[model samples]
Target: MINLQGVSLHRGERDLLDSADCRIFPGHKVGIIGANGCGKSTLFKLLLGQLETDAGRVDLPSTWRISHMAQEVEASEQSALDYVLDGDSELRLLQKQLAEAEASSNTDGHKLAELHERMASIDGYSGPARAAQLLDGLGFSHAEQQRPVRSFSGGWRIRLNLGRALMCPADLMLLDEPTNHLDLDATLWLEQWLQRFPGTLLIISHDRDFLDAVVDGIVSFEQQKLVLYSGNYSAFERARAERLAQQQIQFEKQQAERAHMEDFVRRFRAKASKAKQAQSRLKALDRMALIAPAHVDSPFHFTLPSSDKTSNPLIDLREADIGYTDRVVVKDVQLGIQPGRRIGLLGPNGAGKSSLIKTLAGTLAPLSGERQCGEHLAIGYFAQHQLEALDSNGSPLLHLQRLSPDASEQSLRDFLGGYGFIGDRVFEIVGGFSGGEKARLALALLAWQKPNLLLLDEPTNHLDLEMRHALTLALAEFPGAVILVSHDRHLLANTADEFILVADGRAEPYSGDLDDYKQWLLGFNRDKKRKEEKSSTVSGSEEKAPEDKKTQRRAAAALREQLKPLTNKLKNIERQMAAAEKALAAVQEKLADEALYSGGQQEEIARLNRQQSEQQELMEELEMDWLEISETLEDIRSE
Candidate 1:
């Protein structure tokens, strides 16, 4: 277990946490969540012993090993595989000792044997294979493993860093925004890996679905306090809402009681007969416990302006060929952005999601097609590079002023306040502001233009829960068409009306939800692996004698026969699980009914509860059986 007591941390003059306490037991996966500037990284640093708590004690077992993904890696000539293998410090130390023992003229035979035994015990010989698996899971190609670390781009290097961290064996692991540079496919793979991690894990991420899928609990930073909530991100939201609601109710009740006592004291203070009672009431009022008002204060509150008049189709792409010089990514594309249409773009990394956005934004020209814009069309485009385009010397007030030169200073300040730039902060130079602040400013400028069509790529990258919620609400209320490319599934689910998958140098509509997309990803990866295996076999067969055709056929037949029972069993389990889930859903629906908790319904409620519990248990058992059967089937297929 890890414990922190009375922890107070500060970055410069701003307090991130004050007298905060948190306890995490072994084997618990906790997601740390907060705004961009909120000390999430600082907390990780404190845990890693790189930074000391300002005023508190952080205690953990001295012998326990901790591992964390590095945020930056130095450019090196070392191969990616070797870099990952270096993460296993013990393995490296043993190898070094063995080398030294071999070099010495009087080296003991026993010492050499001992070092080799230790290496084998740690499975050091298999380190390269494990590193390769990690790299593949993170979207690295097989050929890329042998390339020098300095040869990859910045984002690819980040993936290598993650691979290195995952290669390390540790009692605790810390990951901060590991999916920031990952596509949906890699993100899903990482989630699965984290699910199977048998150690304490703390991850900081803005991606809600990733958090919900990977973490068993959430650690939230709010108002300079660290709060621990059970279950996933969705559960944390529900628990927080209930807690705030209860606080509000208590506050209202306290207010009513105080008002009543004050009124009695005011009305009868001058009457002789009621003077004693009035004085007593006044004393009671003075000594009464005061309840603070419930404040779910979200610092962010902004709305998109209504779009200007536009044609039926705000923009159209006809036979579009989009890409850079001498490179075509999406060819023969046809798309129409109609009024009030919300579309999301989904694809693997390097599949040209950003290229499509740039082409639509007119920053890139189509190579061989017509791109049409409505006469009244006005576009608002935002991408990662937009953050860099901001004037560093300017303030929030200055940026807003540039958009509305004729507007009053007070009006501009009022508008900026909605994006959390209140009072004097509006005048402060944005060059010194945090990433979240910079993103908010960029959004404020974008919303001020009132464009009829909006294009956003990864807009939620630096945003927190509150800002994200605010942005979701604003996008929902916006009366315009939107084209979004984001890894934030919650945003995609709530904001996008449909999805378009970009893959294989083409873009087309996908008739499925996010869940369906996940299934498709799994199948795609499996197919890729099979193809690679077949190719490898063909290349290796050149050096060996050809196998007998009859033997090959027999082996295939035997494998099929062996897989039949397992496949049938998997199907039966799926059917049973579906039925159990349906039954459970019906009982939960009944439980949600307010009438179920009324008087004279105790027996009915109890019976429903028993049914629900039984169905849930049945579903869990079926799921386990199904997983086992599926894994067995996969193993046979691989063979």
Candidate 2:
């Protein structure tokens, strides 16, 4: 077990943790959650022994190996695979020793055999394959894995760092926002991988669905204390909500009592009959410990204001080909945005989701096709690059003031406060702000524009959970149309009324939810891999002695015959799962109706709840069956 007893940590004058205590058991997956600067990463640093606590101690088994994802990778010419393999220091050392022994002039057979045995014991020979697998799972292509690490972009380098961390063999793993740089497919892949990880894992993530899917417990930073809660993020939220509700009740009761005492003292202090009673009441009020109000609300509370002018169809694209000057990424795109339309772009990385958003925003013109816009169309485009475009010297107030110079400073500050830039924070320079803070400022600037159409690309990249929830709420309540590209599944599910899949050199409407999209991605990747493998075999056969076509045809026919049943079974399971999901969604939609929960219909509500549970169980079973058959098919194909 890992234990922190009376741990107090400080950064400058800020008290990050005051007498915080948390105990984590072996093989337990826990999520560390808090606001941007609440010491989630700092706690990981303390565990790694890079920072000492000001008071108390943190204890973990000395024999337990630790692995953590690094925030940054140093610029190097090292191949991505080699860099990942280097994560296993002991394996590398053994290989180095084995090489030296084999190359020595004396040729020490005994030493060479011992080194080889040790290497085998550790399965060092399979390190490269495992490293490649990690890279592949993280969205790296076969050719990309061999490229120099420094040659990739910053986001790709971050993926390399994640791959390296996974390559290391350890008992405890610490991951901080691993999905921040990943897309929806890669995020789903990582979620599955982490679920299968046997080690004790502690991940700090703002993505609620990801955390709920992976972590068994939650350790939240609440008012300078680390409070460990049983179950996942949703459970923690419920528990915390109940606790806060009780606290609020107590606070209100105490406030009433205090008010009565104050009133009594003011009315009877001068009277001889009640002078003693008033004095006693005054003393009682003075000695009474106050119960603070529950601070359960999110700090962020803002909306994307809609334009006053009307736009029936905000933007229309017909036969549009969007991409750079060299090539088209998405072809024959036909999309129209109308008032209050919410569309989420779903596709793998580099599938032109951003390119489509850019084209709609007028930042990138369609390579070919007719683009039409409403006369009153106002676009508020937000992307990760917008965060960088922010003036470092300008404060939040200054940034907003630049948008509406005629507006009062008080009004602007009030607007900034909705984005969690309150009071002194509004005057703080953007350069000193953290990524989450900078993201908030960028969002604040966008929200102030009152755009009729909002184009947001991964807007939740650096935002915390509260901010994400706020953004979701804001988007939900916004009157204008929204086009969102985000890996945060919760946000996508809540904000997007429909999905547009940008893939296969085309942009088309996806007739499925996030779950169905995931299944589609799996099939898409499998088909793509099969095509690549077949192409490789064809190319290799041309350069070598030709195999007997009759034997090859027989072998291919047998493989197909073998895969036919499993493929049919997989499709059947998918269809059943889809039906179950649809039924569950219908049940959930009914449950969401206010009238269903309003005073009556208890039996009906219970019936719907049972139906939902049954459908969910059916879905889970179908998914497991699908996975089993898919794995079997993959094993056969590989063989």
Which residues of candidate 2, in runs, are more than 4 Å off? Answer: 249-295, 538-625, 634-639
Which whole-number lDDT from 0 to 100 does residue 233 have in model 1? 70
RMSD of each: 12.4, 12.8
Report the C-alpha displacement of residue 198, candidate 2, in angstroms. Answer: 0.5
Winner by lDDT: 2
lDDT of 2 by residue, 1-639 (tens): 999999999999899999999999998999999999999999999999999999989999999999999989988999999999998989999988878887889977888888889899999999998998888778888888889988998888889889988988989999999999998989988987887789999999999889867787899998999999766675466445435545656546545644644554454334423333223333332222111112235677677788999677889999998998889899988898999787889988789999999999898999999799999999999975788899999899888888889999999988888888887988998999999999988888888889989999999999998888778657755888989999998777656767888899988887776778888887777666667667757353346566799988998999999999999999998889888888978986785464653444656755765575467557756876887798799879987
**Alpha-carbon local distance difference test for all models:** 0.79, 0.81
> Taking the tens digit of each residue's C-alpha lDDT, what string does model 1 give over 1-639?
999999999889999989999999998889999777889999999999999988999998898888899989999999998999888899888878988999999999998898899999999888788888898888877888899999998778988889888989989999988887787789888987887789999999888778877777789997899999766675565445435545666546545644643454454344323333223333332222111111245677678996657887888999999998989999988999999887889887678999999999999999989889988899999986677888999999999888889999999989889998899999999899877788889999998888889899988867777788778757855789999998787777656667889988999998777767776777677667667767776453345566799988998899989988888888888888888888888986785464554346656755765575467557656755775677668867876
Compute each candidate's TM-score over C-alphas.
0.83, 0.83
Error of 2 at 318 (Å): 1.9
lDDT for model 2 comes to 0.81
Model 2 has how many clashing residue pairs?
A: 0
**Model 1 ranges off by over 4 Å:** 98-109, 249-296, 536-559, 576-639
Clashes of each: 0, 0
Q: What residue pairs are clashing in model 1?
A: none
